[model samples]
Target: MKRLRIISFVLSTIVFSTTLLTTVQAQGDKKSTAILDAMSNKYQKIKSFKAIFTYTPDGGKSLKGDATVKGTKFRLKMAGQEIFNDGKLMATYIKETNEVNLQDFDPSAGGDLDPTRIYSAYKKGFKYAFLQERKEGAQTFDVVELTSTGKNSQVDKVQIQVNKADNSINSWKIFQKNGQKVTYKVEQFQPDVAVADNFFTFNAKQFPGVEVVDLR
Candidate 1:
């Protein structure tokens, strides 16, 4: 009877220890979550901004673009050629042989891309951990990581440089577990610019003999 009591006490002690450890770990996770959410909140507050961007991959030709943002309007294009997508913008592009027209958009496309809205919906889509400080030309930054929440998402893990002076995202490096990787470097950020009302319009009459695909 004494042996039975001893065994029962031992089992109870083990269970109690496990429960305590589990509680501690859960608390730690919650605290970590709060830190990340704070950073994301700062990210979502910008109404408009601009930047000069360059992208270079391991073995591909570098591409450059000027990125302009006005409220939810966005325009990103490379030299005279580009692939542009905007949810709240209308822009025009005309070439000797072709022309493109755009209408305002809802900006959220099937959850792939949302300006700072990603954090509000999928805060855990990224893992937030700090890295060493880095300083560049007139820019000091802290690194935060956003990795695929899924095992098979083709997009790679992204490392973003948060500008120390403004708390804005400045640059990105990508690491693909299942695909190719790229690095996007934004050199300049302009937060002041008046975006015209017609900046988000698609006028086919403006460009005759041009293919007008409705992407709205």
Candidate 2:
């Protein structure tokens, strides 16, 4: 199912739970570099934002989803035939439980998944090669591609859209060397939010008949 596939990529990785792992290994140097430090003078610093997503698998109808990231944590909702009907479903394909529940799994849930892990992961994740420059919106963006080494070698090319005005990242694309591609767009952003700790914990008993299927 198209919807399920979208959820798979989003849920499996968790906004680079493992994608940007290799972001720290390389820096841009002219020629093939994609890092645009000069253009990041503005619009590169995102405190928080919301994004409406459409996945183009070689360009079909585009799998739809919405993602909102603030600080180090984010919420992603994908359009699923069964779950999207009401548009309230947030997928949780828990590896530990092997259950695919239509429930929002807070990034902080279960053993404290530090929300900022994704952003800072690249600080020490992997190696990279920067590419050319491109303009998006009012900002000039630099594209930095990543190469996963050692155990991460299978990660293929991960392209990051860097803000020229600021060092912050604008968007990123991940493509498996085998050919699976995923694009994440930063729609709207804010610096921080007042989120309750309870947001991540949900008692399945509250939702009667919620589909719970083991994924592992």
Candidate 3:
């Protein structure tokens, strides 16, 4: 269950990170919105993309993961597990157990972890503003902050850093209501990568002696 939860959260994060500024509310400052718009336009032109990221939860060790996304399909490799979602079905393979769980994929089913809704979350429940600009060596980043307005919101705050050079996302930090924080940093991003539809499907022949659990 814990692993499933992690996968759900990470999957949602990957989608949200990739489409970060698309649906931001109009309440944000003009500078922030302008930066976001540029970033959105940059990503929208790409048909497919691949990213390598580092995930670190509060009080936990950092883990490195890579994900490839093509439209609604995605393949994620992280923490000894590989998740494949071909838009309609999802398969989660655990390396330790040599087992794969297959189930129907519904982006709208998981509340809070729903990738489809996460794109519009900021427009509804959060207030956003331009925080500041930070310079790291030769690169400049625009930082934007979003605060949850609802008292019952699971997330308290979110901070995003966008690279000024190419309008790409650099990293994001999520602060939960329970005082826990999760950070995701993009190590590398490749847009317009060549990939086939079969790349997002799970093949049984790839793993010998693997147990398959079909829950769909």
Candidate 4:
């Protein structure tokens, strides 16, 4: 019965290994979700916030921009584009074409990286893993890696670095399937900044001679 014992031992080893792997994966998933929940909880409580960020693209020049988020309303200004969303309406102005595209604000819409989608994006269409914790100077950052759950997702993976002390997102990197990488680093953040309701709406007078293209 030595052969029978050997077979039983091999089967038991395989079962044990599979269980161990599953448990480890579950623990990692729990950790990643906890980190994301902490960040979302903190940001959801904030009334209004403004942040200056540096955006760097792969093999492209870095650009500096500012984002102001107030509830579901947000305004994003970048090098060639300015996006304004006032909960109901969305306006995207492209400087190169001198055209503004207006659409109904749909949070479930894909392909755009608006400020409204930052925190909540991970909650859906993503499988997250707690990569590791990195210590830089006096700050400790919890790095979480996310892979797109959708087969047709434009982005392949995303890495988010969150400050452990303040539970704030310090930076995030987006890796596209085309091998392009975009990184955004938060330089300055001001929470509870006073913002008017009309600040998120686009005004025709502000653009001067820009053409409005309503695609709604």
TM value for model 2: 0.59
Candidate 4's displacement at residue 192, Å, is: 1.2
Give the lowest summed-lDDT range of ten residues in model 1.
13-22
Cα lDDT for residue 42, candidate 1:
66
Full candidate order by TM-score, most accurate first: 3, 4, 1, 2
Q: How accurate is candidate 1 locally (lDDT)?
A: 0.49
Q: How close is candidate 4 to the true structure, as a TM-score?
A: 0.80
Between candidates 1 and 3, the one scoring higher on TM-score is 3
Per-candidate RMSD vs. true structure?
Answer: 17.7, 7.4, 2.6, 15.8
Task: List where candidate 4 sits over 4 angstroms from the true fold.
Answer: 1-28, 111-114
How high is the lDDT of residue 184 in model 2? Answer: 65
What are the Cα lDDT values of the candidates? 0.49, 0.48, 0.78, 0.70
Worst 10 residues of 4 by lDDT: 13-22
TM-scores, in order shown?
0.64, 0.59, 0.87, 0.80
* Residue pairs that clash (backbone atoms under 3 angstroms), model 3: none
- What ordering of candidates by lDDT runs from best to worst? 3, 4, 1, 2
For each of the candidates, give the backbone clash count. 5, 29, 0, 0
Candidate 1 lDDT over 106-146, as tens digits, reads 43332322432443432433444565568988878877655
Q: Write the per-residue lDDT of candidate 2 for residues 99-196, one digit (tens) a residue.
A: 45564434333211122354443344345566768896688977776555535333565677776666556777777756877676655444434554
Compare candidates 2 and 3 on lDDT and give the better one: 3
- List model 3 lDDT by residue over 101-140, tens digit each: 9999986565443453444455666777899999999999
